[model samples]
Target: MGGEKMLRIVMFPWLAFGHLIPYLHLSNKLAEKGHKITLLLPNKARLQLEPLNFHPSLITFHSITVPPLETLTLPPGTETTADISLNQHGELSISMDRTRPEVESILSTQKPDLVFYDMAHWIPDIASKLGIKSVSYNSVCAISMSHVRPSVLPKAAATSQVALSSSSYVGSVPQWSRNDHNSSVYFGDEITLLERSIISLSSADAIAIRTCREIEGVYCDRVAATFNKPVLVTSHALPDLELQLSPLETRWADWLARFGPRSVIFCCLGSQHVLDAAQLQELALGLEMTGLPFLMAVKPPVGYASLKELLPEGYNDRVSGRGVVHGGWVQQQQILAHPSLGCFVTHCGSSSMWEGLVSETQLVLLPQLPDQTLNAKLMADELKVGVKVERQQNGWVSKQGLCEAINRVMDEDSDISHVVRKNHAKYTSMLISPDFITGYIDNFIKDLQALIS
Candidate 1:
């Protein structure tokens, strides 16, 4: 313990931005703890992160060259953010496989005290063989992790044992269920990777989650018990971004101002899940019918024209000033923290949901595939902090239903909004801070120190 000095940590994230963002934030928090951080990603992903220009001395980005593989011939007119099949990029496995040696070199050279890895291309095995300690970091909630376990959910008739069930929603893996739809319905590749993670991490060191214990305390405990590993539930409380409001950004300001004091509806489906044409039209009609001052961050679907064409009649004209449509990513934390943000219509991604919850903003859940559904169920049912939109067989959200759901959330009549806001505020305040997470890193380093001592 005497020789335990400054710690060095390495992070490897999956290719997608959704997977990268949380790991990047975790790297930031760890760096503040005086640990040297090397974040490894594919070349394109590294380029995407360059603009953030994080602290240089403490943190550095390394690009893994991808081996040339067959191009993923996506559907014509398919948006990159659309809900494509997980196996759509099976060809890219070559690239990931090629990255093994480069990453191994980084580990051998740095000899970091510990490695923190995203549930990406199963690199923890590489880390384990190198004799480096590693932890699996999932951006989703514990419920999702619980589902990824190699067990099927309990029988529908076993009501009493439902909470303890480890039934898989979409597969043979067993997991717990929150609703009737909790059957075999998750990402097969992600499940495979996660199960590999569970096995690889069993003897490694510790498992850290980017969630608060309060929000998913019971589930987190269950996960720790099942995996037989020490678990850390870090909150999503990031340092405040120093942003000043500008009126000349007329679109964002005008839309936000309409929600004056708690009237605006902020809608986003996250970066990965963009709605198709019909779903977009339904959402537009719903927002127009509610007449609520709304700001929708529409990441225009693959085949859709402009946002205006996708909405119901007059949705464009009436909501122009009252509502703003952003086709790309916006500064989400800033928007959530805004005083004018009255309600959130989100896809229930764990990070986005946690941010909204902490900001004391109400939520409207329109979840897509994978762990999102589980997270939404927890938000809407277990926590009583959001509303879920029902879907049809083709997965189309009805316009009238969307309108009704939004109206119910915005209406002062229903106590759901108040309850959601109240609960969100409570969770936000209770979230574990960055310093607390650094403490965990500190402790993990101490254990490593004894080895090299």
Candidate 2:
């Protein structure tokens, strides 16, 4: 290892914004450490990195134009194998067929010192054949990784249930009675995810977790042992942007300004989760019932045409100028940080949770699918900064229940709000700062340079 030595690195991410964004952060961090990076992704994913356009000094984006796979019809806006289940192993075969050539070509020409890839992609072997070290980056929490192993599936199902007492208790995983479905289907998918994960883990030089050991230490230990590698756990590293709102966004801000500090509620279900017609109407009705000044970002999937028709009569007209229902991408971090935003009704994605916590928003978790349930459990149960919306209507979480939860959180007289505010302040202090994350990247590069030396 020597001063000012630069390492050439390449990152290949599956075509999903969640995966692409975190890897971009990692690329930026590495670039800051004097590493040259080549990021390979689809052109559509390029738009997500546009916000970071000013950071051309550190990272380079190289678009890999591959024909879309003919097999496995993907839902609109849904990308990656995690979105659906593979009835057979043939799914991975088709994926590798489409991606391997492009991956190999890049490695052949670039001859990077190291390669980093998403867990789903099977290009670790290609990196090995090229005599290059590589690492695996998982977008989800360690708890999800704990469940990825087949042997641990049964244990996880039982432990996850027993780990939490209720939403009232701290450091406990919340019970999702709805998880009956995830548990039933998990028996098979567990084997599939584990088999693939084992292959990817064995092939990689090391693995990185987008989490801290302080928050998920036990699960991190399980992952490190399962993968048989040095597992490096780092907190989420987001770029410090000088955020400015557009004129339209500024109007939204002005409306928010009307609400006193910690008075307004913000609700958003991340980009991927869409509401059906029935669900959309139910949500609009529920929000109106709460009688709260709320900001909601709604991006229903294309097929859900009935959403507009289903809205309760005059619901939008009644709330006119008081709320904003954005149908497209919104600057989530900026909204979360706004002082008027007192409470958050969220779908409980890890990134969303981190942003809420970082911005000190009182969290009201509504986990939709995938790792979100686990994240909700951690926030409501472990961290105590948030509470889960109580289940009703055969555990479907009806609109009525949604309204009740929002009412409770927005209640100025309740002790829950006071407790939540204090907890958010505590959570922010306990979590590592952005500067600490940058320092971790510096240390990682120093160690990698030592390996080279």
lDDT of 1 by residue, 390-436 (tens): 78777788867777777767776678767766666666665534455
Q: Which stretches of candidate 1 lie above 4 Å from their native place?
A: 1-4, 51-53, 71-94, 151-204, 243-251, 392-395, 432-453
lDDT of 2 by residue, 299-326 (tens): 7544554344556678779887565555
The C-alpha TM-scores of every prediction are 0.80, 0.82
Q: Give per-residue lDDT, candidate 2, residue 96.
A: 36
lDDT of each: 0.63, 0.65
All candidates: CA RMSD (Å): 6.6, 7.5
Q: Which candidate gets the maximum TM-score versus the true structure? A: 2
Pick by lDDT: which candidate is best?
Answer: 2
